[model samples]
Target: MRVISFINMKGGVGKTTLSTNVAHCLAVHEKKKVLLIDIDPQFNATQCFFSGDDYVKYMEDGSDTVLDLFDGDVTRVSTVRGASHKSKKCYEEIKPYKIMDNLYILPGNLNLFKIEISAGSGKENRLKKYLDVVQQLLGFDYVIIDTPPTPSIWMTSALVASNYYVIPVKPDPLSYTGVSLLQTIIDQKKEDLDLQLKFLGIILTMVEESTLVYKRCVETIKSTDNLKDYLFGNFIHKRTEIPKQQLSQSFILDLEKSELSYNLVAIIKEMIKRIERYEEHK
Candidate 1:
């Protein structure tokens, strides 16, 4: 299974949206069995597709919440709550039914935030340990993680678990600094864990074509030696309709036909192709 994480230290960079859309495209369009793990405590990805209100009630017996996993509960490793007998019951109760298939989500909750602090108190690599459980229980074709914006133990845990990392950078100067800081952290983790955490690619999101500032930001990202090699060749342009579509529970391919939607889909297709090529060569 290929484990990929979409992360950025800066918020509002469209990381969750990119992760959801890309994963959805890979599953619905490309026919890949994709598993999306919502590592972020905010549970935006979980709420996006499933019910935000009745998450606790939906969890199965012996299932682990985000908090339980961080606390080192190995028994609940196989206790995932999406698309199973337990989850479907909850889904039926909540209106706005989902059209989901072949895509499994490990729902997140606010309880995870408390666990992050508790786990950070110890020296053990909690995230890596949890990933071993995930690997053993559910061997997936791809595990895409949506992480929180701030640098936390939870974020590091996800990094340690991931093989490929994608950073979504907003078209801003400070956002580049955030990427730099995140890279440094990853490098340190690589040495500590003795793992090759490959940089999949840096995706530029919320791009404004007409703005000179946006163009300058793109040029700056391209000019940077460290990022140039790993940065994605495509950018997702800023568009209001994309968010509107997401709010309406629409897929990327189902969005109103526009240049921006076409460009975003093309970019995601290229990314999947690149990932496949990498796996083939490996």
Candidate 2:
């Protein structure tokens, strides 16, 4: 299975939005079997699918959540939890739903923070180990992991487990810093592990097309020969409605209603196709 992760050192760059929508678009629109693994403690992705009551029942009360896997020896199959009725039922009801025939989700909770604190040092491989179990226990064509914004053990673990990393950067000075921070860490990790990780590309998020600042930043990013290597041709435009829709749990029924959604969907489809081509060539 292909394991991919979406990450950025800075928050509010639409990382979660992109990750969630990409997984949904691939599964629902492309008819691909996808599994989304939420590694962020905020559980924003979890909230996108599950309600509080459902969380209490399926995640809090004796049932397994993502935290349980990292906190213990995840070699056993029992550490992972199955999709809950609430999540399943919700997916069934959402209009213009794009959850593909074989898509699944592993929810996250607030407790993930503590798990990171306890994991310490070499346990960063916990995510990789548990993913091995998941592959053996529940096979899927792809695994998409959504990580937290800040640098942390859990985030690093997710990177270590991924075959490719997609970075979302906003067009601003601080945005460049965030991208640089992650790139530095990724390079360090590559050297430390002596592993080769293909950088999928950087998606510019929350950009306003009319703004000179945005235009200037884009030019600057493109003008740098080395930075050019990090950018994806597809840049995500800033859209107020997208996040609002996500917050309201709106479904993408028709792409005609929102150009942003349409373009985002197109970018995601392009990414999937690119990855597939790479794998085929390999």
Model 2: per-residue Cα lDDT at residue 154: 71
**Candidate 1 C-alpha lDDT tens digits along 66-93:** 4545443223222354442222122112
Error (Å) of candidate 2 at residue 126 is: 2.0
> For each candidate, what is the lDDT?
0.69, 0.71
For residues 1-282, could you state the per-residue lDDT of candidate 2 as single tens digits?
888999987888888877877777777767677888888989887776666676667643544556655564332222345543322112112111123367677787686765536334676776687777667766667788899987777787888888888888888878765566678888887887765577777788888889987887778777766567667667677866676677556544234557776777778766866677677866
Give TM per candidate: 0.80, 0.82
Each prediction's number of clashing residue pairs: 0, 3
TM-score of 2: 0.82
Q: What overall lDDT, based on C-alpha atoms, would model 2 receive against the true structure? A: 0.71
Highest lDDT: give the candidate number: 2
